[model samples]
Target: MGLAAKMDAPRIDRGLDDIYVKETSICLVDGDRGRLVYRGFDIRDLAQHSNFEETVFILVHGRLPTREEYDMLRKGLAESRAITPDLVRLLRRMPPDAPPMDVLRTAVSYMSNFDPERDDPTRTANMRKAQRLVAKFPTIVAAHHRIREGKRPLAPNPRLGIAEDFLRMVTGKRPDPLSARIMDVALILHADHSMNASAFAAIVAASTLADLYSAIVAAIATLKGPLHGGANEAALRTMLLVGKPENAERYVLDTLANRGKIFGFGHRVYRTYDPRALILREYARQLSEKRGQEDLFRIAEILQEVTVRELKAKQIYPNVDFYSGLVYHLLGLPMDLFTPIFAVSRVSGWTAHVIEYWDDNRLVRPLDYYVGPRDAVYVPLDQRS
Candidate 1:
């Protein structure tokens, strides 16, 4: 081979950006058109027409549920909503200053100890475990937030749906119907998105035949990374810092000039405006108006326009995080709990991927191109000089 050909022969995909590592039937991320799909259904439809419980059922079971099936799933979620009393005491004892994501990771790990099916990888058992996780994660998060705020965690109200129950638990008051609807859509939007980092992490753990809780713990740890799942928190902070619509342009220009990342404006996958962001942009407006925070929403709008104008040619556009934080803020969620709430939604996707991984499982071991010297002689310590 020519030298040029030799040099090109082993070009490994750095970061595996375009590499298709495995096949999945759970979700499809249409990066080109910025659409997200769950089991052949458009996320926009699911977000508009379905609730979190239904969307999660579709993701895990690979189809929409019949009314009986839907009712069963909802009943399971409702019945399993209470965390163990031991978990509650543990939550109370945890460091109040700990990062919510870290606390969530540890909590999931601890929860596995109480699971009767902790070691069972059977499909039925895994599904049952998934039901418990979906039910308890919001409770865990709200409880943690409550403890840190010097309030006792409230028991979940089984009469309400997950969104309303979580809101009530965290804020000590039931969310209005519209706010609950917004929260439901947010959960559906975040439920799944192909094999994002956290799902990939869960799959890797499952590829090793680890238990479901361990796999999800892996996913939670991965999602704790700022680059992967913390973008919404950072994005909201940016808008908060910018403070007003008129100041957005200067803030973006200065940040870009300094090579600082403007979080929420770009994605590794989507080349077009993110469909979730499109839906949330409107919610942010309406909810902000309701909360008398029109100025805050306007700042986001200005930033969106400025960034889109400057970066659209590069195919860098908003990807879900841009408006989500604003909505969360209007809902009275604390800033630190933002990513944990992401976990609350994404656990459905992570467990779904893990369950699917075992169907035709293989270890996810990839080779790296080594660059260091291959041959070297070791010198005795006495002869080193």
Candidate 2:
């Protein structure tokens, strides 16, 4: 092709919105019908019946684990849950006020130096790395939370599952059965969404044949963007500002009148309600009642009612972010830790995608149509403009 023809080539899919880069069987997101299926299991069923460890196993392995397989997976995760002492010292050295997500991104990159299989690219090694990542993410987030709070990090309890251990480490108290179960379900819900920004970012990095940790670093950085993973924190702040159920209508009306986004009410892919949000809405209600924060839940309910009434024609509805923040708050998590908690769950999905993509790896280079001047005359060093 000539330069002129190339330069004038029509652009296609500006944001890759209509593109299909690869085939995936990890998760299916049916936006029009409001369904989410992970490895052919409906999200509602998984949330109701499966634990986080089991859910993660299904995502990575593509089938329900046998009882012996489940035991091994659990044991692997538990054994890998503790961070090295050097990592603890690094966390202590980090700026106390750094955003937890930033800290997490850096910490994940640092961990690559110590991975036993860092030099190996075999499928078995990658699977082991994936398991280690899923296990340590909670520990990393919780340890950073404690260090920033001027408290010493707690050692992992080998007997506890990921959700229970994270809660125990972060709060220095053994989680109640209900709170632990809620945390487990929350993890399962956030474990993956098909072709979301961060997961795509992970696969893109992996396409370069990068190591698992490096690809996860890319994912974490991408997820830190407000348009992607930070919505839950922003949404929760808006709810707190509303402060009472009575204020919700005024808040929503004014925000809508000013054409400001009411965070957590819409999604890029879902034209109907987000199924994850539907599951979490009930949990938010239950936890709020238990924690004596029913007014906050009431505020959310009012916001949802008004927003749906006004915007249902546009197909706008509550998304996963809407109730997730409330659930985290009622579980005693701080606001800044919200997005990090998202990473804690999503690392499972990220690694799964990375490993799967590597099975038939290809470079993900896309072309940008050049629009600059074609034949600019070169000027001598002393030539006038």
Candidate 3:
């Protein structure tokens, strides 16, 4: 082996900037161009033209479906909504202070315990589990939250889209139509990215031929980092610190001066606007009008402006995290719960990717460039003492 080939150290948690595996389909992101696509369809077009259910179908099955197939997929999602009564019992029993993501993790773990085919290694069985998880995730998360909050869980409202249904479950009231549509697009935008950290973790775990649940567990751990799924929660907290629109620019500058990486500005992927940021920006606008929180909207606008100017000065650009937290705020979600809600959307992608890996499983072994000191001869145990 060449000197370069002899190196063998782990790829520690430094930022990875290259693709190391083949994926059949993905949400294509041109980070420099600020574009997003699912399979071959652009994110902007999909957000405008599609719903979460259809998008899930596209992600899983690798194409947009005909009307009948879409209907079938929708029905499957609907039918898969119920968590086991025992699952509900378990959720209610979890301590109130338990993190929602932890609750969600337990819920997915419980699913494998209850379902017979959950451990099956075959693609058919794994796909069925994937469909169930994709279907039930929002239901489980929302229901678990409500139950913990001492409210009765709302059964899935079939009349609403998945986003609306989730909101209905969460708030114990129907979301306003415009608000629901905005959130639908938000969920669509968050659904998947190509080989993101969590997705890669899921693929790596499954490449070991572990059961899907085990793989998903590893993925969730990766996502729990503040730099990843936690970004939205951080973004919202940052806006709250600014207190109002007029102060946004000053606050951003102060943060920059403090050498703080303003959460939501940088991304490993997008070099320009995060496509999701644009979708959520529309949501923020709509909510501003409906709720008459124009000041909050203004704050968000200023923040966006500041993000661009500051990041440009620093040679960075806004990523999806930049504007999404404000939309969640305008939608009246609890600030801290933002990342948990992200897990609710991202579970679909994680499971889908895991199943994909299982279909053509291989241990994800990679060569590394090690530069540590060479192996030294061990001293005799007694002599050293």
TM-score of each: 0.95, 0.96, 0.90
User: Clashing residue pairs, candidate 1?
Assistant: none
- Which tens-of-lDDT digit does each residue in 1-385 have in candidate 2? 5776877788677778988888999999998999999999998999998999999999999999999999999999999999999999999999889999999999999999988798699989999999999999999999999998999999999899999999999999999999999999999999999888899899898998888898999999999999899889888999999998999999999999999889899887899999999999999999999998999999999999999888889999999999999899999999888999999999999988988899989999988776677898889979966
Q: 378 in model 3: Cα distance from truth in Å?
A: 8.3
Better of 1 and 3 by lDDT: 1
lDDT of 3 by residue, 75-149 (tens): 888888877788888889999888887888888877888788866888778877878887788888888889878
lDDT at residue 241 of model 3 (Cα atoms): 79
When sorted by TM-score, best at the front, the candidate numbers are 2, 1, 3
What lDDT would each prediction earn against the true structure?
0.90, 0.93, 0.80
Choose the strongest candidate by lDDT.
2
Candidate 3 segments whose C-alpha is farther than 4 A from its true place:
1-15, 367-385
* Candidate 2: C-alpha RMSD after superposition: 2.1
Minimum summed lDDT over a 10-residue window in model 1 is located at 1-10
Off by over 4 Å in 2: 1-7, 378-385
Q: Which has the better TM-score: candidate 1, or candidate 2?
A: 2
lDDT of model number 3: 0.80
Q: How many clashes in each candidate?
A: 0, 0, 2
**Structure candidate 3, residue pairs in collision:** 7-370, 8-370
